[model samples]
Target chain A: MADTATASATGGSEPAIGRGLKGLLLVALPVFLVGWLIIYPIIAAIVSTLFVEATDGVQFSTASYRFFFSDPYSRANLALTLWTTGVCAVLLLLVGLPIALYLRFSTSRFADLVQSLAIFPMFVPSIILSYALIRTIGPNGTVDILLNAVGLPKIPSPYLTPWGPVIGLVWDNLPLTVLMLTAGLAGISNSAVEAARDVGAGPIRVFWHIILPRMGNSILVTISFTVLGIFSSFTLPYVLGPASPEMMGPFMLRTFNDLYDPLNAKTQAVISFVFCLFFGIFYVWSIARNQRSQSR
Target chain B: MNRREFLAAGSAVAAASALPSLALADDKTIQVYSGSDNNIIDFWNNTIIPAFQKANPGMKVKLVDAGDDNGLRAIADRALAALKSKADPQADVFENFDARLPAGGVEAGLWVTFSAENVPSYGKINRAAIDMPQQLPYRGSQVLLAYDKTKLDPKDAPKTWEQLVAWVKKNPGQFIYNRPDKGGSGGNFVRRAIHEVNGRDPSKFTIANFSADYAEKSLTPAWAVLKDMAPFLYEKGAYTSGNTQSIQLLSQGVVTMVPVWSDQVLQAMSQGVLPETTGLVQLTDLALCGGFSRLTVFSNGANKDAALKLADFLLTSEMQSAVITQIGGFPGVTWDNVAADLREKYKDVVPNSIPTFPGGDWNAAINDGWYRNVATGLARG
Candidate 1:
């Protein structure tokens, strides 16, 4: 019985590639496509940045990378991208976690409504969200008018400020964050919480001891995905953020289009890729670890 | 199905889907890709193409709406690639082509040069309007200071760059321009500011005369001037994103004045998006940068002859007059060359001279520098 269970769990006791020719043929097209479409362009871009055309001939140079690191404006843009990504990730977790927790524990019909509401942002396009944000919180917009009606002091708007992109990104990222966290919460059985509480552990103790650790992988996955999404976001940042000290997405675009400097644009892109590599590594490691533990 | 039968079906489907487009690519068909607005697109599809086709039967004109600057740039890049590979460029005539695009294509001979011998109407084009031999100038519009006449008296309107600055400062938070990179109205305004800081001489900057060092030295003072004036701008240095937004601000009574394109403002007023009380004025010291929209024939286009015929047809007296009446643009041909009635009708609005800012590197430098020095330097309210 144990042998049969293990055999079925490990795919009918066969070596992974035992199907050989048929399996290879099935995977060939997709593998070729990924290599051609994704890996090849990334490699080409990185290689292009390494080589520079000098007066004498095409020579190896790190001038583009050096310029990106040394330039103050470029550094500021990179710093802004990192800062915004960090802030949005934190905000997403803070806003998404409680709702997810409530949905997981609650039996009320309102929980269904709450879950749907939490995931509603997924349907809203970023451009439409940007426009809607501007209308709600922009200068002389709905918020301002309401505040004026109540005779409150006028507040400064976030539009065209660094906060603009942050607000939009957090709102845009909330749905995915909630979905991931909710799925993680769903895995912790109610009996686990009941078991902890019956041992005289309070609600806080039950949550801290019985719930948080189990959802650790989901939280990490959420942070990784959120950071990646916010880092490379273009439309929200372009429409909402300040002209200077912009995110890398807009910076690379302006460099390529407005400034008409393709080499610097490629250099900017490579730097962005390098920055995102850390999160990419974390995400892959987390997934692999999860798979290993699941198999065990 | 068996693998062989499925493969045959897939191949047949692919060929069937491709057949129509292959049939459409014939010798008699010429594709004219235009990046102009819907009004201009309508002018081409409804007016120009029909008229041209009527005159030359059996010659089909396919109008491809290239959408915007980026779209046109993509098409230009395709042409450049085709030039390198020695293939047909698929596109023939490019309307509203910025000749400086695709970096070095002009120098690489990607477009056909025009002269009276090739395009008969070329001789009648205004010498001042013609910027290059490769471009055929067809229509134009200039940037002007557009104000709400109902609010600000016309007599108090700014007629020079210095006065414009003074006026903006006098009425704080009542004037705005867009980010220079986002729109040409604001770009021309910034160009005029550059000219103003450099002793009002528009001659110093040229298409080829751009270097990082030169830009740093020449643009520092202009940056200082713009930065100094930013606090008085709408919402204390908040700039709108585009030309339409600037006009929208003016219409909303949020701003009293903005730099706007002549054609756009007129159209907006006619459409009632802008009030009828909106007024336009050109600076007397130096007119804000205005440019002619030029069409170019691709050197490697398969339908070069048909394209050239269309280009010549665009400059005819009837078409030039229609350009004024239909699109609210100044005629590309000289006043004397156009119909007498149009010359009389538009005499009041004819510019003394349209000071054009060079595009290639100068344009990119000014836009980038404006963001770095001017927009970024605004003090938060």
Candidate 2:
């Protein structure tokens, strides 16, 4: 591998300019399309929020952003989005890591079943998941019926509450989290685990020292992905969340569509994008570090 | 050729290329854009379109289903753009067009103003139903309080806004409404609350009367009333997301009462989704807010004549009666003009007066204010 790497490095250096041009030509269409479709719209939305219509003409103004920061309702929505994202990220890791670890270490036939179950949520569309969740846990729904059969006191439903989206998003995001963590766990050689065990390390110590340290990149990637997904999520939150102090997804939608206030909606979008940029930076940095370590 | 001559020649070619399709579009084809529910869409596609086609042999009406409010707004924006450029708007008639939209389209003469000279059926239209001259009021649906008869006695049903509030407070966790932004039923309910607190005068709130300062002052009392009643709501201040969910909660026996649309409740009963014991009543002191769905014709449409003919056809007694029986809506024309038997059948449901809440800025303010003041009673830390 080292010899081949060195040989490729020398060869790449010799025809560097020509190969670079060829690679640029190969990526030109995708780069242009992405610039036109995604980057241009994002830039345009951010720019439009900065310009406000005045009596004379359009002028630069941060009044919309000012309102977003100062208005208690808008601030509450932003705080709720951040809170939901953080809680879902923690919950996804809590629920997903154990299944991933079990799937990685177990050699039984049930391991395949567990792996399939862990990944099943990816196949279920969010709209159907929302409906099924409502039927299962909504007021006087299936859970209520079952609880009533056992003569237990009625439980307050999580539907239409802040926890609604948290439950849904964690379930909807479990498959991707488990997949990523399992792939990270696969990188830990069995010999290293055996060595830890040979040195009188318990299961918890082995996980804490060997497995956890090795899977740090995966955990970071998982959290970032989960955070980004939960932060901008619309359907689950719209269907399941409270009417006010809603997450930014439904807040932006209601502002634009229901209130017919596009300026405030764009301001909200820019704010959400700014918040998501932190997780995006984390994701990009983790991937870059992984690439650097692999090359080393 | 010089630069100017070459550009002129290029324009000529482009115009020549577009001429055939423009001519084809003008061949007695009127494009009708509708952004209503499935039942209304079905009424247009199955009942109205075929009837209109049969009545007018040569002329044709193409129904375009604008899927939702956003889609409808896109069509309106396209019309505004056409008005600016003085070009043929692809859409001729916009069914269920809120006249306050396109932000001064009415003032700009984007839509054709109707009169008895243009549309003869305009003479038969109920004068009380007309909100503006620019729109043709075709059908209407009012918000009504729907209660389960099994739970509440009919004699004890609240008849006025005062009694209704007392009843909600008396029966905690028995009443619910949807989020105002999500459905017209809840919006009208909130509007009624605004009226109730503001001396039950609907005239004080007009299309042009909404200001942030006025809203803050007037809505403060309404918010207090709503907040006071919030704990008495089903699930203890938890509101349903939309009209359908409100009715669903009532049907599931989770709540005993909810505000719902008259047409929707009738349809739900016909479909047996709601049991027969479900009863509907409007407040006596002041009826809940009701609105007539209006249609506007673009002045720049290619088939303006055909579109006007279609608009006139909608107000005819035959079509108006069909709107009553088929879609469970109040007719655009007066009751005397409708079929007598059908009029007699729907007498109980007919609203004596339809108090309309203004749509433009007032709508946005009330819905957003409700979310902030009323729906957020249990805001999380």
Candidate 3:
């Protein structure tokens, strides 16, 4: 492995100009594809929202944006979305980081079982997960029946509340966070950990100084992804969240489909994309930093 | 050649290449886009379309079901988008429930207008159904009370709006209707309550021109009554989100009663999702809101004449009766024309006429208002 790495390193030192042109050639196709597929639709959506159609003709107008911002429900929905996404991302870090750490360091059979369990949700579609959560936690559902069987009072199902999405989002985001963290931990050197332990540093101290610094980019990626996923999510929050303080996903859908307000829906979608960029910037920054480090 | 001549040559080549496919598409085949239930689609494809094709030799009809994911609303959204862009729509006929597509298609000039002169079946259709502009009524559905008979005796069931309130008060958590924005049955239930609470007259709410001021003034009593009734709903102040959800609750005995579409309940009963003892009630005091799903011919379509012929064929007695027997829907034509057995079965619950769904803007306002004033008001109170 060392010989192969050395050979590749030596080979990689070829003249910068040729390598740079080759690199650009390889990336050009992907950049063009991304621009066409992702950037074009985004530009179209923004442009569509900027124009207003009247009896005479289409003209430049902020009518859609004004309509969306003017509605109290839209403002409430935005806040609720931020709250749900923020809380879920934080909770996932608190819960998932420890699990990832344990899975990374331990080799026990229980750790292997835990690893399998953590990734089990990756196979389950969000819609199926939503329904499963409903059937398990809904009124007169499995949990209710179990509680009744044990002669216990049935607590109202949380599946219809804000906690519902929190639970679902945490579960949904777990696999990806764990996978990223585990991969990140693999890159972390064992010599540093051993040295820290040899020097009599405690577990928390080692984690704080040695592990946390190494996992910075991974942590950012996980948190940013979790926030983005929850913010733009539709099926889970729509099925789980309360109707009045709806998240932007279901709210925008209802506005466009049921209320027949396409313009407002498009405006709301643009607003959501703008909000996502707040977290999305971290992802962009992480990628740029990684690219810069690699180039160096 | 110059750049202009070269570009013209390229354009000519592209157009020539596209000629065969375009010709194939305009080969007199009528395309119908429907988001109707599977059973209705089966009846149309198996019985109606084949018969219509045979009657009109050298003509073809194609039925496109939107499947489970893309429903009537999705189809309407796509069609409307195409119409707004002034492009030819893919389908000739657009069929779906009134609430899902609404009569707004007619008002927007998206549908072809029909009268007795153009459509012979119009003479057989009920006069009340005929006057709906640009709408061709093909099947009827009414919002009705569906109850588990094992839990409540049919004789003891609520027969009027007042009786329903009293019964609900007596037995709380035993009934539920979906949120109005979520399902047509629930929306109609709210609309009916609004009409019944103030007065028994349907005329009061059936204004030709919708006035928001008049609605606010007249519907004050309705809001009060709905607010009062909300607490007694199943799961205390909580409610289901859709017609299927409420029906599932009923089937599970989670709730003994729910407001559901009559035809939907029938279909569910046949499928065993609902028990044998389930029964339906149409209140006498407040008329159950009822309307027919329309088979609309798109104004900008490839085959207009064939589409019109297919629409006419759908309204005939044979197809209308098939709608009842196969799909559990009321006939679009005069009630007397329906099969005797099916008519007798649905006699008690059959509505006298199709109720008008308020104009699109009015509907949007009312649905939003109810969500704010009634649905949330109950929760807070």
DockQ of predictions, in order shown: 0.38, 0.49, 0.27
**Model 1 off-target regions past 4 Å?**
A1-21, A149-154, A197-203, B13-21, B81-86, B100-108, B211-214, B338-350, B378-381
Distance from true location, Cα of B63 in model 3, Å: 1.6
How far does residue A256 in candidate 1 sit from its true spot (Å)? 1.4
Residue B33, candidate 2: alpha-carbon lDDT: 88
Q: Ranking by DockQ, best first?
A: 2, 1, 3
Alpha carbon lDDT of each predicted model:
0.86, 0.88, 0.79
Flag regions of model 2 displaced more than 4 Å.
A1-18, A51-61, A194-201, B1-27, B379-381
Query: Given the true complex, what DockQ would model 1 score?
Result: 0.38
What would the per-residue lDDT of candidate 2 be over residues B307-326, giving only the tens digit for each residue? 99999999988999999888
Winning model by DockQ: 2
**Pairs of residues at least 3 apart in sequence or in different chains that clash in candidate 2:** none
Write the residue-wise lDDT of candidate 1 on A1-296 in tens digits: 99899998877667667768668888999999999998898899988889878899888999999999998888988988998999889888999999899989999999999888888999999999987887778767778879989999657878778888999999999989999999999989989899898889997888789999999999999999999988999999888887778889989988998988889999999989987889999999998988898999
How high is the lDDT of residue B15 in model 2?
100
> By the DockQ metric, which is better: model 1 or model 2?
2
- Model 1 Cα shift for residue B296 (angstroms): 1.3
Consecutive 10-residue window with the lowest summed lDDT within model 2 chain A: A7-16
Over the full model, what C-alpha lDDT does candidate 2 score relative to the true structure? 0.88
Query: Between 1 and 2, whose lDDT is larger?
Result: 2
Tens-place lDDT per residue, model 1, B1-381, is 888999999999999998865875666788888888887898888888898899989889998998887898899999999998987778888898877777789888899999988898888898878878999999988888899998899999998888999999999988989889888899899888888888888888876787889988888898899999998987677776678768866876668999998888878888998988998888998989887899989988988988899899989988888788877788888877678887887765667578887777787788788887777754341
lDDT by residue (A1-296, candidate 3, tens digit) is 99778869888756789899989988999999999998998898899999777788989999878877787667877877888888888888888889989998998899989999999999999988987887787767888889999999987777456777778888888899889888888878889999999999999999999999988888898888778888999888876656557788988888876677878888999999998888899899997887788699
What does the lDDT read for residue A54 in candidate 2? 90
